[model samples]
Target: MGRTLVQKLWDAHTVADLGDDATLLYMDRVFLHERTGSVSLKGLESAGRKVRNPEQVFCTMDHIVDTLPGRGDDTIMPSGKDFITTTRAAANAAGITLFDIGDDRQGIVHVVSAEQGITLPGLTQVCPDSHTCTLGALGALAWGIGSTEGEHALATKTLAVNKPKSMRISFDGELGFGVTAKDMILHLIGAYTAAGGVGHAIEFAGSAIRSLPQENRFTVCNMAVEFAAFTGLIPPDDTTIEYVHGRPYAPTGKTWDAAVDYWRTLQADDDATYDKDISIDCADIVPTVTWGNSPGHTVQIDGAVPDPSNAPDANTQTSWARALEYMDLKPGMPIEGVPIDAAFIGSCTNSRIADLREVVKVVKGRRVAEGVKAIVVPGSSQVKLAAEAEGIDKALVEAGFEWRESGCSMCFYAGGESFGDQERVISSTNRNFENRQGPRTRTHLASPTSVAASALAGKIADVRKLG
Candidate 1:
């Protein structure tokens, strides 16, 4: 009956019940970026309204900024650049702190908030990007909101919505080599399908999730959207506190201990309830990659693509066929040795220091294969600084990977640049939906190490083989 972290945070943030199943929840922090925030700002302007609490909101320029730094060209998506400029001006006018380009602290919103300690355990966080759930690694109830809803949060600090049911995904045992959190979640996605967790807030439990580092856990939580989960989380514990301590905005000295005590008090009671639960043995997971459109269309690198003839129903058959057609993949084809045109190692999902270090360890002495375009981008400016300080950036660049600036580059086609149409990219970013990287680009989602290995071999390979 132990109360889960989600319940405790929800209860603490609840302002009032709105209606049947709906609650007016007070958000602790709101993050804004380009694209969505500008539209929301225009909506606010159209409404002739002002933000209710500017101090609680933070803005950054991540989505539209040029990730290949020193470009000096500044040719960004038209709407994107406007959004950044407008959001920054509005934030400044409203007294909201803004992290614009050249802020030193500037980076992807998720990475910026995390590195700055603006996001902490037992807090309610929201952004206009689905991957905002990446903050849940700190034991927060973080999720994404629509532009209009984001505007409302900025002005009112509250959002009205029905409570999501809770689903617990328990993972046990240690993961084997090349098997990572991405594999564990991908396997879960394959088991549950894309919409499996619809209307549920998933709480990832068990030793496997708990034992993994923060970056990997963030990677797992980042893909909660692909499973149709509203948000995903792991409870804050010693690991959470250790990661937050001494961070830029984190509580310091005596205030730090007080905050820790308060965070502990937010744990769920022993008799808390969940709408559903599932378990997975981590030892069975392996280096994984997606062969089709949806994240569920994945398997062990050593496995072959599924033959849709195995589909239990016609709906599955249609799904399989559509996925295969979009991916230009044949049923039952071997997933390994599939040629790749590009390899990317970045995004909020797997662009942290740990991920870079892991990939560098795999490709330290190896050069990228001929005919492969590979690049490495850190998640945050601070992450870039940390990697370079440790010489990981040099190692990756020496191996022929482009070491670029920090941002959500190639995670999606936000910067007006993208992989060529019909090109195949082995990427560390989440989501393999059609055109996620470009209008007609193909994406193969995998872990940082797998991406590095694929870049070196110019094909999908089990990263563990390289080590």
Candidate 2:
């Protein structure tokens, strides 16, 4: 019997069989952010236990740090400075690597980990954030944990987790122009609903997925949470090896050769079986947008908002009605022309350098529409530097987009920063639940290009139609 990649990684990391599906798994790395990282660090300190492997832990400020270029520890979130200060003091005292505000390595936890080679294939990584699975794009078995679980991992270097069922989503065929990984995932969620992959860890495969650039795979895996999957993965390939090579923390010399050889063997066998299997043809997917609150409440860019009366069940009908009301959208209305008051182009989901480059392409010679407030935030300081070097930041700023520092800004209204109530926004960030960006803030999530185009048009515009 051939084994799936999940089983291979699982068996290798299993430290003990606790029975009842729970196994004590060795953890290779743990990344933290200011918002929840402080909670775990503070808890560990209160318990008088030191991190078993401080070197394996890394911390950065993201969730609450101000993304303004000249910003300091102060933030839009009330008492946000405390999170930054506490996390810094705790991290330094514990000897863990801290990417302080001015550090070049400072960025979102997931982005820094990948760009620095801290996350590698076949390793187990966890963080106190849901989007931790973004690292799984590099073939690592990574997922999010609550602050308590994070504390346990920090102290013991292991976590007792119930193995999840395995599922495979195969993307066959070539992607069309202007159709991105963001659209592909949105289309899948729309077809399968948000809860489709519940209790499963997804392995994204097939030619279309392999065709994506390494970092773009992060964009695809970033939305795995929207599929309700435990995590998302893509086995390391030649491109993966090349991307990992020369990264700051990547193995060197003999270690590098050995690691690459091992990563090459991390794929699922040809005859491997999975609990569920789904096939999506890339040709069938187009630029998509979410008209409702959930990622699943999506339609083609050219399509109309769904009428709740056509829903398959009463619950679904109710959900549809509520989403439409909150979104201020009318049934049968075209999604393309929906008015937007703000546009945000940053988040763990789609804020990489490649994403920024795409944004520049769409809005380079244009200005933001009058009355629209648009901002471009890089995913990390390193990305910000790279984009600046390429003049991407200049183009964005000149085109009327606010070029801000890197952080998870405006992705959600976690702290004091928000788009205010009842404002409609087209964003590159994930999720559009009611009040996610602000109280009553209506969010339509899309690709950077789409966000850029929508910012120019002051509506939910499609990138395909941009001149």
Candidate 3:
């Protein structure tokens, strides 16, 4: 049988097998942000250890930096400024590249890395954030690691990890209008529940995946963690190569030619085998929305809230009941027109330039609902500039969406800004767990376009209904 893409990446990066499923894999790149980067860097300092290869390490001021324009080190979270300063000092001492505030290249770690070509096909990347799998869309073996593990990778350039079982999820057929990668992912999670991909490295493949723009592929891969997967990847293709070519940090000249040639070979063979396989027909998917505390508690925009009595088992029934109570939603209630207090349209999951552009298309001629507080944050400084240059920012601002600077604003409430307890928010973020946005805050996750429509209606309005 032909080897799987995961096997190829593993074989190429494996230094040795340590028995019991553990392998010492060479790490091609290590990324960090302000929140957890400081902890790892401080650990190295205390141990008087030097990075095994500083060139492979990079740090950015994303997680804790305020996204407000003209913002500095000051932040609303207590000691947030200290984290930034400490990371800056340690990153400088370690000789690692630091994308500090005001750096045109600065943004979310995942966004900046992809934009700068720091993440490429057939490489290994890791960060201390669960969504690090976002980079795996380029066919890299990327995943999250704990801070202590990050320290070890910094000092050794290798990590001991057990190889995860491989699975392939093929999205077939063509997606319908208003259906996006975000909706497709949400549908997958809802169908299989949150633990569906546990212990597996999911490879998203098939006609539908190939149809997406390279950036939209990032959206699909970004939510892999929510499915409980070890990581997620999409083999590189012509689309990916085109996206990487000529990037700021991408290989140049002869190196570029060679890289493309190699990346082209990164796809799985036709007869490759996997431990598990699944197929979802894209034509059946619609604009999806989460209805409760978990990403798995999702329903189609036109569907009704799930009734716990119809759940498969007692445990699920109890879980569904709790989610409904927490969300202040009733079983069998129509998901559309559910009132909301706020809307957020930015996060590593859905804060790219394309996401912002899609939202603008929905908000251009409409005003936000009178009682709604809506905000739009770009994923990176570069994305922010690009949107402004295209008049996207002006459109959102005029529609009453607070056009803010980059950084993961409102994706979660850790930044000292939150929608407050008991507030209902329709957000274009990855997670909707309890208090994900703020203490006791109820969140409904959806695509940027859906968020825009909901904000305009001041309720859980479907984008398809807007037209």
Window of ten residues with lowest summed lDDT in model 2: 412-421
Give a tens-digit lDDT track for model 1, residues 85-200. Answer: 77777777777788877777888888889888999998899998888988988889999989989988988999987899998899999999788888888889988898999999
Which lDDT tens digits does candidate 3 get at residues 189-225? 9999999999999999999999899889999999999
Q: Candidate 2's residue-wise lDDT over 119-159, tens digit each?
A: 99889999999999899999999999899999999999999
lDDT, each prediction: 0.85, 0.92, 0.92
Query: Can you tell me which runs of candidate 2 are displaced by over 4 Å?
Result: none
lDDT over C-alpha atoms for residue 59 of model 1: 83
* Candidate 2 vs. true structure, TM-score: 0.99
Candidate 3 structure lDDT: 0.92
lDDT of 1 at 56: 75
